[model samples]
Target: MTTNEPRPAMTMRQIREGLGHIEPGQPDPIVQTTGYTVSCLPEDHDERWTYTVRVSYRGDGLWSVQCRSQYVDADGKRSPGFCWSRGPQEPATQAEMDDFDAEQAEWLKAYRFDHVTALRIAKQLAPTLTYRGRTVADALAEPVA
Candidate 1:
């Protein structure tokens, strides 16, 4: 910031809020890196990310919720929709390829929902999801493909 401030570049507050972590009394991870060039990619390889929730019912008639996420890279290349298992992939699981880091795919993992739970999430995220500075409903209302 100002010349009077310390040269470490990141305050404890900055580390917790900006980089999303706190390592008390340790060097800031971003400042400790070899190069202080970039922190996060602009749009994650120019990809448009999409999150989908699929609900299926078992024989018992309870809804079994699953999530599918697709990432389309800058070149308009898309990853398969599911790739969570270890080892060589079968044709069905081969649709996803964004597993380079576990944290990237972590958001899609925790969604076990019934009718009530699904409605709770929908109510919360309906206001949260935005496209081009508009709400999810507005985005859906647009005829843009």
Candidate 2:
């Protein structure tokens, strides 16, 4: 398909289906859906999936956003990528939390990126925000332990 082709925006159901696989050390029983970003892996191999989302507690408490990434191999094995803070920088005040929540809702409502956008975010965030798949050449160059 041409790069310019418009793909349908991912539905809430689809997004929910691909999210927050509890990697050890990740908070559980309460990953807030919020919004997410995604990307496909390197070209020569079977397609792998990479996704990132902001999560927080569902109940009353301090509100903060933790950036979490999920990596799914071509065969669908789940692996942890990395996690970091997104906004409010933690120890958020009630006012900050309210503002962040409002801004986030607006941002999510206005933009739902397609594969192209996801790919861009993935490429840019690689080595920092998300897991990267090894390329064919790299695999061959390294000795298998």
Candidate 3:
């Protein structure tokens, strides 16, 4: 005969690394942040910056998403720049959790929507944009119209 035991809460690093299951009191794993170049800029344009959406599990049962911008350097390094964040709000009920999930999805979708638009633009302007390139399109991992 074996007795069931409660597992320990995951550490932030463990959660971020996806090393374990999240228990009730443990924070949810953070989604990896992805950076996107502004669609309006030319592929080789100087002063181009990357925009990113970040979702984090703030401790104490709270979660938040941040919209951030970073300057890309000549060598492709990024500067720690600016952001706008919403919520460290705790969802205390199943309904609230569902709402939080929906809201988070919307925020992530909004960040990615620009890439889809850019792809459509690229497809339409293909010959003219023959030499231009995109990095964010791979992040979507699906073809878009």
Q: Report the number of clashing residue pairs per model.
A: 3, 0, 0
Q: How well is each residue in 1-145 modelled by candidate 3, as lDDT tens digits?
A: 8769978997675775575455445655578434322233345534122323333433333233332432222223333332223344344455654654555644433322243443343233222211135444442333433
Model 2, 45-143: lDDT tens digits are 232232333323323431222234333322223334322235323224456445445545443223223434434443444333333665434443455
lDDT of each: 0.37, 0.38, 0.38
TM-score winner between candidates 1 and 3: 1
Which runs of model 3 end up more than 4 angstroms from their true locations?
A: 1-3, 8-12, 15-113, 128-145
Using lDDT as the measure, the top candidate is: 2
TM-score (C-alpha, index-matched) for candidate 3: 0.20
Global lDDT of model 3: 0.38
- Tell me the tens digit of each residue's lDDT in model 1 across 65-124: 332343222222334433445543322232444443574344233322345554444333
- List CA RMSD, all candidates: 18.3, 18.2, 15.2
Pairs clashing within candidate 1: 80-95, 80-96, 81-95
Q: How far does residue 103 in candidate 2 sit from its true spot (Å)?
A: 3.2
